[model samples]
Target: MQNNPKIVLLNGYGPISINNELLELYPVTTSHGAIGFPLKSLRAENVTIVTNLINFWSLTKKMKPENMCYLYAYGGLEDEDMEKIKATSIKST
Candidate 1:
C-alpha cells in the first residue's frame, strides 16, 4: 500500500485542470500497477477495474467488493509505454 498510486477524483474533465497539473509533477511507472479503464468515460460513478491480470483480479475480489475501480486489461499504458516498463523489470512471468 505504501507504494500504490493514489486515486483522485475529478468533477469533470477539463483542460488546464488542477489534477492533471498535479499528476504531471510525479513519476508514474507500471510498477504502480494498472488501475482500470477511465470510469467517467465509461459513465460509471464507481471505480471499475478492467484488468487482465486474472489471478490478481480474483485475489482482490475475494478480499473486497468490486468497487468502482478498474483493473483494465492492458489499460493505461500504450504499447511503447509498456515496452519501457518491461525493460525495467526482471523476467518473473
Candidate 2:
C-alpha cells in the first residue's frame, strides 16, 4: 500500500470514462461518494478526471465499490474555481 493513498474525488453525473492512456497508468473506478471509489491507485501520480453527474442519484446505487474520492461541485463553484480544485492539491480533493 502507498504511504498516503490518494483518491481523486470528482463529482459529476452519468457514466464516467477515464482516458485509455490514463487507465493504463492508474486503476480507476466509477462509484458514488468518497467511500468506495478507487483511492490507492491515485497515489501512483497526479491525475485529473472528468465524470458525468447527469443522473447520479439513481445511478450511484448501481455502481460497484472502488477506492476513490468524490469532489462535489453542484454548480456552487465557478469554472475557474473548479479548475483550481482539480489542479491545486490532493488535500483539496
Candidate 3:
C-alpha cells in the first residue's frame, strides 16, 4: 500500500469519482448475507464506510484512527449522510 491512506467506499453505486477525483473501486460481496470485507487486509489509517453497523464496528476496531470507519445510510440519506460525515469529519481532541 502507498503512504496515502487507503479509501474504501462500500456499496457505492454509479461512478467512482468523489469531488471529481477518481478513487479505486473495490467490489465486495453483498450476497449470501456476507459482511463486506476488502479483498485484502487493510493497514492502519485506512478509511472505509459500510451500511451495516456490525461492519462499521468491525472496521473501526480493525483500522487505526477508528473515526475513519463510518456507517452509511442508504436511500433518502441526504441529511443523515451529511450528519455522519460531519460527525466524523474531525477527530476530537
List RMSD in Å for every model shown: 14.5, 10.9, 13.4
Model 3: how far is 45 from its true place, Å?
12
Q: Pick the candidate with the highest TM-score.
A: 2
Q: State how far residue 61 of model 2 sits from its true place (Å).
A: 1.0
lDDT by residue (tens digit), candidate 2, 1-93 = 533323334432322333211332113223323322333222212322334444333334554443333343343334444433322224322
Q: Which candidate has the highest lDDT of all?
A: 2
Ordered list by lDDT, greatest first: 2, 3, 1
lDDT of each: 0.28, 0.33, 0.32
For model 3, which pairs clash? none
Candidate 1 per-residue lDDT over residues 1-93, each given as its tens digit: 342332222221112113223221111212243222222222222333333356444543243332223324333434433332211111221
Off by over 4 Å in 3: 1-47, 66-69, 72-76, 79-93
Two-way TM-score contest, 2 vs 3, winner: 2
Please tell me which model should have the higher lDDT, number 1 or number 3. 3
